[model samples]
Target chain A: MTDPRLAYVQRKTRRRLAFSAVHLVLYFSFSLNWSSWGEPLSHRLGVTQVTGSLLMFILLVLIFIGMEFLFLQMESKETQE
Target chain B: MKAMFLFLLRSAPLLVLSGVAAAAGSIDGEVEQQPLNTTAIVMFLLFVVMTLLITWRAAKTTTSSAAFYNAGGKITGLQNGAAIAGDFMSAASFLGITGLIFVGGFDGMILSLGAFAAWPLLMFMFAKRVRNLGSFTFVDVVSQRLARGQIRIVASIGTIAVVIMYLIAQMVGAGKLIQLLFGLPYEVAVITVSALVLAYVAFGGMLATTWVQIIKATLLLTGVTLIAILILARTGFSFNELLSLAVEKHPKGEAILSPGVVFKDPVQIATIQVSMLFGTLGLPHILMRLFTVPDMRQAQLSAFYASLFMGYFYLVLLVLGFGTVAFIYGNPEYFDADGKLTGGINMAAIHIASAMGGDILTGFMSAVSFATILAVVAGLTVSGAAAISHDLYAQVIKQGEPDPKTELRITRIAVFVIGLVAVVLGIAFENENVAFIAVMPMVTAASVTFPILLLSMFWSGLTTRGATYGAIAGFLSSLLLIVLGPQVWVSVIGNEQPLFPYDYPGLFTMPFAFAVIWLVSVTDRSARGEIDRANYHSLLVRSEFGEKAAGEGAVG
Candidate 1:
């Protein structure tokens, strides 16, 4: 029989991988076709041209940082259980 | 292709730094040797003295193999995370990328994001399992559930191969910087850097190395923060205004705001992104830092902190890059007689530093650059030494249990050998095509190290024979593709056409490696293969629960 801890940790690992996969997909979509991706976003947002491209890049990086925190938070939840 | 290929970095500066080695006197055009900046000398000397004193203290407790390899796993996640950032952010890379943005504008932000993609990848895939399973080097983790001796032999070959190339490029780059900064002769600079690296790893080990990294990271972060803040203040704290002013001054004008103005190619992007992604997974210095943490959670925290710091750092570079353009681009005082920026484009961040706070801040940044070289090279040397001592010697030659004192002695000896090798190679290859040397470490990491590491942890069917064959295949194929590819074949060998068309082979080679390992493993019906498959259960339990998992599994 599988240990409950193994089951719990595996679920956590799956979630981490799933989240990271989503992040990679976001990154790769832009990276692979950045010309098109940046074209629409390159339009000026408000007072500046800090448009879709820069905003999207910033969001991706934040998600990069946020994914780890999200994982750690999930980890804390497990310990409580 | 060259522009895209430049994005593959364990540390971003090493790639541009290779060119800086050659760009010293010839390309910068009539730029005379920089005078010995007294402030820089004083700052560097103070840093060296403090680090050496730390090394002396570290030497006292570095009596066992664990202390030597990983500081007895005593580093907290926050501290280890800062060290990882220091190791990742070479002063050269930080300045180099910022300078890139200073010249090219928005594209540099893309490259920063590209380099940063590694952090999430590492946190999800490598950090947790590697910390739980790996003891000293990556080889320890890779060899855990397999045939230990044979698997280590394979993994160690990859580690040592990658380390040697990475170490040599760093040594050569450090030498060039020292010569440029201190106005010293080239050979003297190489030897001096080598001597310091020997003192750090051979004597003080990881404790001294970690502290040096932490200190350097703190100084670099502070310098970048101060410079970013000072530059933003000039534009009334409005990032949009800064970009607008940059558009006005830049030669390319509004085109600088577009993505493809400098470079945009889909395949090239995929290739660099692939290498940076997988290469981070397989980089020995980073993988080595994983074991320095006490547990898996701390390991996760370390990667997270590194990501947070790097994210903040990259955002600053984006602003500072545009800010430098707005302020310094057309400013005649900062440019040379030919109307080029003095000391080429890589000096963009330095010029901004001078503008921000005059010679004092510039000198501090310069000293931090030199300190960065030391910390990076020291980490590489330790990883290389551990590959020789812990993986090859103890795990392979001594059958996995060498005497502690004996292993420690072997590690120090290996350190000396690598130091000597780096010194000789640094001086010998000073004028050679450094780009060729720069990409080799990534080829091995992306193809061999990352593939095997991923498969070993995730696959249940892997056998020793399959792993060995798979690793050797991946390493050779990647190396061959690189030699036949654009960077080496066309750029270095003067060929009209590259046999392999891409700048990097990882986009093809990584998938090929996974296929080879899978194909070989599934076909292996040997009894040992069965045992290898069965061992994955306990390996999984141990990896998930760490050392607290007793015997076969954890009993919560």
Candidate 2:
């Protein structure tokens, strides 16, 4: 009654967890640097407090997109393997 | 894993600082004063028309029960994702959170952030399971390994509880928003929203609701983004300056950033967070969206997209809330004759928009708000209807095959019935505290349905007896607790003091439900090896990657 499918699923699960772990590290490191970069841009952009907040928002979104892209790439490699 | 920990660690400090900032606000100064404008009227009409058009278009294609209940299973991952975003981004997110943040500061954003954070967990936990189940109701997913009759009874309770709670919250919010923005009578607003949502669901079914949600989500995101940009433009792009402005206007300047300054009660903050985060993952209406997508991968992808969309929208709300705080404090016009913030806290979004964007933008924003209400109600109605027509009536009662025609008729009728029930409930409970009521039902649903659903998918030992008993136990305990819980007793029943410290039952009830299911399953020897291995495999793996696999099978 050994199910090959179960083993396959277990392997997939492990790989996904590994991928997720890598993603978490990248996002955390990137987010820390974001505020420092955003502060200088806020001054240079001469936007109001709210506008500066909005720009920060835009930056966060960009970073999220990059992370998602990285995730997709990782997923693709796993699928190929 | 490391990345997630890092993300959490980085966010921890900001969250703490923000908590401190929120506590300094006095309830009196936190309210806004603003005049209602003509723009709100135009926006209302626009949403009404948009809803009608979408419903009419949906009616043409929704010729069968499947179409009505599950959009005939035709919706793409992207479309469904947008719709999911639309459904989740209710008037509460657009208006309530913004207003709460505007008044309460960082504490409000914490609620928003916590709710948004639940999306990824949902993706990981439920997305594949639900999509694989391929059933129209949460009952279908939970009942796959259990007896049909038992699943129906337990699931119906969970479904009704969540829908009723959610409907009441939306109706209350709609009534207040209508009165504030359009001078409509509260009763009239409630009836109008109920009727519009009913019509949208009845005629178009899931197709109409899905499109409406997609459109609404797009508009809401766009509107918030635009408003955020406008606010930033006014502030000269300085996050610190915006904080300074907010600080200067307050008596307890800079203290607004500190936690406990606004809410003062740590328990209340914790309660709000738990209810928002767990309640989100458990919501039947939200989880039902997974079934509408084409496959498991799409289901997962849609969730990811929804998280991104919701995360972005919440960030804008944070800015909008702070913008309102900074702008509205000095304005005498925002106050009523008694000098109380003229409208309830929820009106801050409209008031801020009116002030910043003038009449046209205000009108546009109001329309979007109206659309938000409409979109959310439509999603709720469709889910409710599916529970009745697809789960209870067709599957459990008739045991009929879900032929295209039967499903369509049943769905439309169910939509009408569910809509009627909501309207009646809304009318009767018009005076109740809508937010509190809404959160309670979601907790009940989450406590009951969430465990049953997860166990049915992953736990092979789960038997019909176990699932049935567990779901019932979870459903009753959560409902009873909520009804007798201090929040309900004091707030709804007008008791002087609450019996329980925590408002949410999830911290207790959710775990209890899972424990009951496990215990019951383990005790029943007959339950072992009950899982239909072939069926489960087909349901989960084949449905996800079967197209290519099917081709190979044919060659063999």
Highest-scoring model, DockQ = 1
Local accuracy of candidate 1 as per-residue lDDT tens digits, B240-309: 8888898888776776676654456767667766766777678888899999988888998899888888
Residue by residue across B1-556, what tens digits does model 2's lDDT show? 2232233233332222222111100011121223455677777777678778988998998777767777877788788879988887766566666665655555455555555655665665567667765467677766554566666777876787777667766666666566666766768877888788887888888888898889888888888888888888887976667777876764445444433334455445544555555667777788888878776667778877887888788877877878887887667766555444556555668778878887777778877776777788888888887777777777777764556576667777777877777677777876654434655655666677777776666665666667777777877777777667654777578888767655566667777878888887778766332543223443445433432323111111
Best by TM-score: 1
List candidate 2 stretches off by more than 4 Å.
Answer: A14-73, B1-37, B264-268, B400-404, B527-556
Q: How far is candidate 2 from the true structure (C-alpha RMSD, Å)?
A: 8.0
Could you tell me which 10 consecutive residues in candidate 2 chain A have the lowest summed lDDT? A26-35
For residue B27, model 2's alpha carbon misses the true position, in angstroms, by: 18
Task: Considering the two chains of model 1, state its CAPRI-style docking category.
Answer: medium
DockQ of 2: 0.13
